[model samples]
Target: MTETITRPLSTEEVSEATGIPAGTLRYMRHCGTGPRSYRLGRSVRYDTSDVAAWLAAQKAATARGGDAA
Candidate 1:
């Protein structure tokens, strides 16, 4: 059996997909509030599926009237 590998997305790509600025993404990294990230040395990368899951979770929270506070 063979496992398929998916390329990890750069911050710029994620920014384009999520409309989140790179700086804010960096802040989220620092605060651990955003999607899960993989730190490969100095490079930060995200899995698209993880980002999608996080976005779905955020939407569900909003639908439940949960605040970031």
Candidate 2:
């Protein structure tokens, strides 16, 4: 038997990897509310690094009481 290795993720895959539900992911896409994503033809993808950066920004904002701003 052979095993296959997968690449990091596309946007939908990233949402699943982060346990963020699809509907919310779609809303985020619509609102531009989440991590930066790239479009490939008709598909959108997110870099793992971008997701991490987004999370770090969110945490820093919360820690600095800048979340609501």
* Candidate number achieving the greatest TM-score relative to the actual structure: 1
Instruction: Output the number of the lDDT-best candidate.
Output: 1
Candidate lDDT scores, in order, read 0.90, 0.76
lDDT string for model 1 (15-59, tens) is 999999999998998999999999878889999889999999998
Q: Could you tell me the lDDT of residue 60 within candidate 2?
A: 76
What RMSD does model 2 have? 7.5
Give candidate 1's root-mean-square deviation (CA, Å).
5.3
Write down the TM-score of every candidate.
Answer: 0.81, 0.67
Ten residues in sequence with the least summed lDDT for candidate 1: 59-68
Clash pairs of candidate 2? none
Scored against the true structure, residue 34 in model 2 reaches a CA lDDT of 86
Quote the lDDT for 4 in model 2: 61
